[model samples]
Target: MRTLGNILWFLLGGVFMGLLWWFFGVLAFISIIGIPWGRSCFVLGKFSFFPFGKEAISRDQLTGHEDVGTGALGMIGNIIWFIFAGIWLALGHLMSAVACFVTIIGIPFALQHLKLAMISLAPVGQTVVNKEDLTRKY
Candidate 1:
């Protein structure tokens, strides 16, 4: 079921979103100082490809300890990201969700877009994990 949904998502508009993420990643990479943001963009871009069976979670929650990405620096990073690329990416997802909501079959896709939108808003301290993995100790 997840496979089918992911295939449908990829065929519908997920590919475009993933490409956009990669594009942002490339732009960030070119800036050198934005390497951390570039890396996060690539990771989230991959996540955008097949989001059905996975979720984004805070690193602190997953590891039971605070890390650089889950601390004050992470907050600052998120703020910078939100100002630079997060707003645009989140807006794109919101628009996609709105378009998907036009039909019943698209409702699920719309929900996924909403999830992506939320994640896009503050991606720095988050990591993508399988639903099952989220339950396991890491």
Candidate 2:
């Protein structure tokens, strides 16, 4: 089921979305100071590619401890990201979501887009993990 959904999503518009993320990530990397944000972009970009069966969760929650990415620095990073690239990515996702929502068969994809939109708002400190991992003892 997840494979089918991911294939459909990739075929529909996920490729574009993921490319946008990677584009931004490259830009951020070139800036040097934006390396952290670039790293987040790459990670989230992969997540954007095939989101089914995977979930983005707070790194702190997964580790049960705060790291650099789960600290105040992460918050600041997110704020900067929001001001620069986050808003645009979220907008893209939102527009895609609206278009998907127009058809019954697209409802699920629309929901996925909505989720991506939210994540795009503040991707810092988040880590993608398989759904099955969430239930495992770490």
Candidate 3:
């Protein structure tokens, strides 16, 4: 089911979103100071590619430790990201979601886009993993 959904998502618009994330990642990678953001973009790009059966969770939830990406610095980073790129990416997802919502069969895909939009707002402290992993953690 997940595979089918992912395939449909890719065929619909997921590939374009993933490419957009990757493009931003490459732009960020061009500067040493933006390496961290670039890495986050790459992670999000992969997540955007096949989001079904996966979930995004806080780094603290995954590692049980407060790291740079999950602390005060992460908050600052997310702020900077939101000011710079997050808004645009999230807006793009929202637009896609709206378009998908036009059809009943696209409702699931639209929800996924909404989820991705939330992640785009503050991706620095988050990690994407198999949904089953989230279940096992608690």
Candidate 4:
């Protein structure tokens, strides 16, 4: 079911969203200070590619300890990201979501886009994993 959804998502518009994330990631990487943001973009890009059956959780939850990307620095980084690329990325997702919502078959994809929009707002401290992993303690 997840595979079918992902294939349909890729065929519809997921590929474009992934590409957009990667493009921004490359742009961020061009600046030394933006490397952290670049890494987040790469992560988000992969998530956007095939979001079904997956979830994004705090890095701290995954590791069972606070990491650099899950601390005060992560907050600051998220704020910076929100100010710069986040708003634009979220807007793009929003538009996509609205379009997908126009069709009954696209409802799931629309929800996925909405989820991505929320993630775009603050992706720095999060990591994507299969949904089944949520039940496992770190």
Tens digit of per-residue lDDT, candidate 3, span 1-138:
999999999999999999989988998899778899999999999999999999988888777765535668888989988988899899999999999999999999999999999999989878888988788877
- Write the residue-wise lDDT of candidate 4 on 1-138 in tens digits: 999999999989999999899988998999989988898899889889988889988877776776445678878988998998999999999999999999999999999999999999999878898888786653
* Candidate 4 global CA lDDT score: 0.89
Model 3 pairs in collision? none
Residue runs of model 3 more than 4 Å from their true location after superposition: 65-69
State each candidate's clash count. 0, 0, 0, 0
C-alpha lDDT of residue 79 in model 2 = 91
Tell me the lDDT of model 2 at 73.
79
Pairs of residues at least 3 apart in sequence or in different chains that clash in candidate 1:
none
lDDT of 3 at 48: 98
RMSD of each: 1.9, 2.0, 1.8, 2.1
lDDT of 2 by residue, 8-119 (tens): 9999999999999999999999999999889889999999999999998888877676544556877888899999999999999999999999999999999999999999
Q: Which of 1 and 4 is ahead in lDDT?
A: 1
**Candidate 2: residue 48 lDDT (0-100):** 93
Model 1 — which ten-residue stretch has the worst lDDT? 62-71
lDDT of each: 0.91, 0.91, 0.91, 0.89
19-128 in candidate 1: lDDT tens per residue? 98899899999999999999999999999998989989887777677554567887898999899999999999999999999999999999999999999999988899
